[model samples]
Target: MKKYVEIAIVLIAWFALILQLIILKDSLANYFSYFTILSNLLVAISLTPKLLASATSFGKRFSLPKTKSAIALYIFIVGLVYNLVLRGIWEPKGWQLVADNLLHVVVPLAYFSYWVVFVNKISLVWKDMISWTYFPLVYLAYSLIRGYFVNWYPYPFLDVNKFGYQQVLINTFFVVLAFISIGLAMIYYNKLMTRNR
Candidate 1:
């Protein structure tokens, strides 16, 4: 049952990404700029190995509890930020709409569920929570740098051209704060669950 659920998640996530890739093929660079796409890509990549019932190194590595937890944190933020901050900023239509919801809503929830139910939480620690921030920090830096060169920001709050440096930095600080807050909560949950078990 877990394998089937994971397979479904992998298929759905990849389907949404591929649909968006097909629709936005002309501006492939811009399409991949969004954190939504990248985070969903991570989820799909991390979860894909579950479908392969072989004892491969890639599968074992990604199957690590910390790896799934980190990816879960990323996709969770993608859903929260999109719905809370980015939703209604622009309306997507047709297949793009389907892709939008899948990336921002369905995939996040599904992957988090998979992590909560299937991932081993006994090894999670405060350090793991801190380490999880690396991906988002790197992504933020890459987005800001690329946007400076390309004059295109994936999300409005991070748009330095419009919000300027000070505001963007503040916004980024809050986003990181939110990430930390959730990471702490996740770590706490891990401890609690493991203790009970």
Candidate 2:
């Protein structure tokens, strides 16, 4: 029952996000889509077996690692730098770009931090990697298709029209690499934590 509730929270959050994007299809280009994507990704990762196990007594039965939290923190930091500092989107005084970025990027990163650092207790593994990676991969594909018809993309990283297909693909490759690295780091972290405890 509790597991169902936890899963429900994740699903509901993602559903609400999708509904918002559908309704605001026009304005979704700005930054809302980015936020939705990131938020949903975080939620999905949180519901993964390794992370969920940490919250259960059974999680202690296995020799979990400690690298999950560190990786999550690293991802959050990189995301912060990418969206806020390097992108120059955190200027709260200007065109509300900062606010938009904060809602879409900052908030979700914060959630990831909380989940990885304080909530998750289980060790991650290859299976956990597959599960955690699925959501973002699907979301990225959906966003690309949607961007084609809508003539709008949620983030600059995915703006193929502007960057050209080759560039977009290259950037996407890098993004995938980053995600994979982070995922592996998270798995290691979780294992370390479990062993230490």
Find the candidate with the highest lDDT and give its number. Answer: 1
TM-score of each: 0.96, 0.59
Of candidate 1, the 10-residue stretch with the lowest lDDT total is: 46-55
lDDT of each: 0.89, 0.56
Question: How high a TM-score does candidate 1 get?
Answer: 0.96
Lowest summed lDDT window (length 10), candidate 2: 62-71
Q: Pairing residues by index, what is the TM-score of model 2?
A: 0.59
Those runs of model 1 whose alpha carbons end farther than 4 Å from true positions after fitting are none
Error of 2 at 87 (Å): 2.6
lDDT tens string, model 2, 31-92? 44563446544444555543366656544432133333433443454465366534663344
Best by TM-score: 1
lDDT of 1 by residue, 1-197 (tens): 88889889999999999988988844788887788898999988887875774378888888889988999999999999999988989998898889889999999999999889988778888998778999899989999999999888888999898889999999999999999999889989989888887
List ranges where model 2 is wrong by over 4 Å.
1-32, 35-78, 84-86, 89-98, 104-109
